[model samples]
Target: MAVASNYLLDTGPLSILCSFPLNASPYIYAILQYTKITLADSVIIEAGRGKIWRIVSPLFKTGEIESTTTPKEPEILDLSYGNDLGLGERSTIKSAMQMGLTAIIDDRDAFVVANRFAVHPIGFQDWMVMLSREVNLPTKMAIEIVRSSANQFPKMFLAHILKLLSE
Candidate 1:
């Protein structure tokens, strides 16, 4: 079966790249190459001038990162009200819904909202699984990447990833 052709990443994934010393996640890079990865202008702004931007801007220049405007749905904003949803997350999800693409968000509330809209929401572990299938990334390397990104990732989430890799 072919993988889905669309993916929308929230700031979490970008933050991971910035916090980790390793290069971009191979799985995410593969998805970008094989699928249409959409980014709201807000997300790009959130990913300001940093190491992540330094690496990602080239991809944008090369047409890998596509910029999009926010959606005009009132309901989408209503969904985000409870959580302290930032502009980037709100805009990213709005764009994903507008384009009928999957939203890759690690935030629980965002995932819930995405699900309500019938938009697929994938988390970090899901991406890791995809990467493991697409490339021969050793479990050790994956663990190291997660460990290095500890500051950006929640301890529970990091422990969960490590446990998954161990198994």
Candidate 2:
């Protein structure tokens, strides 16, 4: 179960990750151990407006996460038509499409749009499960991360993942 060497992250996953302390930043580090992460520059600018910037900025500085300028292609803009997908989502999908990277997007609409564009996408929850199963991330830490990010997930799905971790 080899994960992609690099993944393009959208704002939702980035914001959820902000809950972790920058000093520790365990999950991001754990993920980094298995795969590289690239953020669209638009995500940095969009996330800068909130607490997410506090975490994303330092990781960028430390070289734990990389950033890329969004391509100004019309295809990137085309993904947003008739949808509420934001700049961050569009950029991530576009980057993933062009760069052969997986799009790490958690928003349902963005997930569907990414698929429509033939770009592979993984939700945060599935990403965590992969980390646990493939990367051997500790069950306790996986449970904690999932619990902390519960609001972003469906209740039944959360329960299922918790059960899987507990097994």
Candidate 3:
């Protein structure tokens, strides 16, 4: 497996990115590696419908995001604990681990599993921070939108980042 110095997006983050309609934008560009974000093959197929496809399909044609499949070799990252993760999440994490890449996933169970293996997991809240702070989005709006969406993400995690963003 090739080492991915890019953020590997999972289905959840991809969906939320598509769904978040901010200023007539899909809001996916806030991801720092937006130009380099990739989707596992399964995730691409999974996200190949609805709002996500509309936003990301053009990017695929423009070569902004890449589509990759699970490697046959270099099957790293023990999957025993990732049973709760869906196929896309599992492959995303596994692929990230093998390639030493950070995974952009939003599932709580997947986060816990990624933590056990020391793989960097960037969830929705983290994306907000990246948007407001790193990506230089409107901090106030990013915080409000992200904080209010706590029900869709991890509340505590969202609170932590919001606090940090406020500081």
User: Best candidate per TM-score, number?
Assistant: 2
Error of 2 at 16 (Å): 0.9
Better of 1 and 3 by lDDT: 3
What Cα-based lDDT does every candidate model obtain?
A: 0.69, 0.76, 0.71
lDDT of 2 at 68: 90
TM-score for candidate 2? 0.83
lDDT of 1 by residue, 1-167 (tens): 34445567898876674455545444345444345566788888987887667767878888877778876785647555636777787877778878877677988887777677677778855666555455545566666666765566567777667777777
Q: Write the per-residue lDDT of candidate 2 for residues 17-50, one digit (tens) a residue.
A: 6766434664565566666689998888878756
CA shift of 134, model 3, Å: 3.8
Work out the TM-score per prediction: 0.72, 0.83, 0.77
Pick by lDDT: which candidate is best? Answer: 2
Q: Mark the 10 consecutive residues where model 2 has the least summed lDDT.
A: 74-83
- Candidate that beats the other on lDDT, 2 or 3, i.e. the better one: 2
Show the colliding residue pairs in model 3.
none
The candidate 1 region of ten consecutive residues with least summed lDDT is: 25-34
lDDT of 2 at 103: 82
